[model samples]
Target: MKNDRRPAGHVVAIASGGLDSTTLAYWLKADGAAQLTLLGVDYGQRHSVELSYLEATAKTLDATYIRLDLSGAAALLAGSALTDARVPVPPGHYTDVSMRATVVANRNPLLLDLAVAHAVSTGADAVAFGAHAGDHTIYPDCRPVFVEAYRRMITVANEGFIAAGFQVLAPFIAMTKAEIVRLGTLLDVPFANTWSCYQGGRRHCGRCGTCTERKEAFALAKVFDPTGYETDGG
Candidate 1:
């Protein structure tokens, strides 16, 4: 059993309380890689409910979870569905390009930038995210290209004091949400503790794009979704 204490020099995971990130945390932990510091960004998104789950997930994994709220900055993006109630969260399976607006622009850059800083300051060797291929078409920042760029930047940017610089890892960059869910199951991640609804409802709206994808992922993985949700008979 892994202890909760932050390791002297460990790997840091970017945990958004979404399936992918939570799964990453569990996978790394299962591998007995090292102690992990779970990083969650509260960017003024409507689905703040997910933050609660982030806390629970971290606690369950015996990992340290820290929050960096960028809500004040994210609040400026009024048209994004994650921030604006009027945007009307889109429903059903949508491609990444079609779902682009939902992305908080510069979100990945800012989050990873801070994560890098955290890694350097704390002597962590790497920073990881839950970005998958499905996100690439819509969220360029989630793509491998961007990840590699950041990795290079982090290395060249911090070449002196910390010779053991940081690296950005995205293990699922080519997998789909369903594939991620499947992998998560293998890692023994507590799926119920992860939240993916874009709507800030008590239960998942089940109609939003995120909920739909999440439902489909579990379905594809041939696993039952244990989360609470209000679904319409479709």
Candidate 2:
């Protein structure tokens, strides 16, 4: 007997439990565009605790929650501040030079592979994630070129198995974090439930690149941020 945990839905959304992804979930649901399966990936990140927020988001959205653990890859993906204990998480603006240490080296392709595989396995038509404009500066994989090529590559990768009209969606691709925050405010996304700390501390380190970016996003959007930062750095 084979176990089948493949995500089954009109769209399997990768939920990172961060501001962008959580907002994406709420937006998709409220937009009434697609049936959602909130999928969370755990590649032994320092912030595995974010999965709990992901589960909370699933419940909030009343969507299927798939927590896929690829923790074994942590060893192979060492040196990244997120997966390596030795490398300290960088504290600065997200796009600054120091923040490059957070790159997991082809991380998005690996994560998106899960969405595609599950989409193919369950005959789902689409796979979605919340890669936004801010991600483009640091993450090569988050760029439109990569996403478009990835969609095509995956289509060819499983030509027979994939559903017709299958799509890899990154709706926030062109939008800024501030814009997303504004939209999330309109969507009533519980911002406090999202997690962005790379430190995985009791509260957001607030000094890390992501936290700084998160604070900046809220400020730029003129939205009141509910997140509690340990350092009050940003």
Candidate 3:
């Protein structure tokens, strides 16, 4: 069923070139979004290869691609394994204790703010991102409460503007990653082009929390994953 809450107009998607975000982009396109803009943030994370995927995805979807430089801010937000080389990217399932090392502070909030601002500037009616139920346990920003609060804040902040009725859309907020995979598969998303490894090697390490989760989601969804992994072992 199509979400009636989603306004019918230009929409900006926070694309990270990961499974979730890429899937979201494809979903938007499938839903006949008139004007779609993909916003990618370059935050100097270890998995910079995803930026390449971001570009490719934009081309595939025929959407305008905009890259924002947040590398300077990443320096101050160091200490997380993703942005700091000194810290090791943890290997295990997402629920493991060690996976907390990968959290970047206020990542979702910062990215959403940028996406929302871009939408406002472009006269877009909505801004979307892929935040699923699985992330709620590890990322507070991905939780429903945070998203609802952010939506309210954006509504209040844009008051009186010509295109003031902006929406923060998280279509998969209550769905599991496996469910997202199934939806993406149905939408024929190019999964092979998406990147999820924190190591940022030539191929996915297949050991990091993200890689593990990606593999698990595919398995749970019964979808054939086309991602190239460095190792056969999960």
Candidate 4:
């Protein structure tokens, strides 16, 4: 199938050091992104360990890695479980109602804004993010409508610059986490080096929504997960 919207040339990827984003980075490179830059945001989330994995993934991919410190944003967007210590990170499946606490208000937009600015400054043709179908239920920003609307907004916001070929890409927007896992496997992504738990512990807290999702994705993909969790969610 010919993709009319195929991405090419310089690309900036918003990476969170998780399975989806890490996979997205590798996929972009394999799909012929001439130059790739991985952008990680430090918004004072509990799982700062993900930043470490972000750097490692960039090294593995031989892409430039940049970290933007948005810790101040955490204070402003404080009610979410990820940034607020008072609100606990919930356990169990991602579909659970309690998992909504993990949503950081306007996170995708804020991150995408930063990424787009970086892309514009650096002469990038596209900006990519790893948001997937699994995130739609919990994160409003991860849905297809939001992505398309944001793309249109960016296009209009850029005006004449749109002719320069600035595109907002979310390749996995319609894909499930398991599908991403399968694709990542095909791309030989180093899943062991990735991090996804909401808790910033030494090891993954398998009970957390992300960790559980990760485990489930690998299982569903029939891939052997190398992640070492503090406890077995199974």
Scored against the true structure, residue 134 in model 3 reaches a CA lDDT of 89
Which pairs of residues collide in candidate 2?
none
Using Cα atoms with residue i matched to residue i, what is each candidate's TM-score against the true structure?
0.90, 0.93, 0.95, 0.95
Worst 10 residues of 4 by lDDT: 1-10
Displacement of the residue 159 alpha carbon in candidate 4, Å: 1.8
On lDDT, the candidate that comes out on top is: 4
lDDT of each: 0.79, 0.85, 0.87, 0.88
Query: Predictions ranked by lDDT, top down?
Result: 4, 3, 2, 1
- Estimate candidate 3's alpha-carbon lDDT, on a 0 to 1 scale: 0.87
Predicted candidate 3 versus true structure: per-residue lDDT over 50-113, tens digit per residue:
9889999999999999998888877977889999989999887876477678889999888988
lDDT of 3 at 11: 88
Please list the Cα RMSD from the true structure of every candidate, rounded to 1 decimal place.
4.2, 5.5, 2.0, 2.0
Where does the lowest 10-residue lDDT sum fall in candidate 1? 1-10
lDDT of 4 at 124: 83
The alpha-carbon deviation from the true structure for residue 214 of candidate 4, after best TM-score superposition, in angstroms, is 0.9
Please write out the lDDT profile of model 4 over residues 1-234, one tens digit for every residue.
112154578888899999999999999989998899999999989998899999998998899999998887788888899999999998898664787789889989999999998887777888989988888877899988898789889988877664375678899988999999999999999899999999899999888888888999999999999999989653
In model 1, which runs have C-alpha deviations exceeding 4 angstroms?
Answer: 1-9, 163-165, 232-234
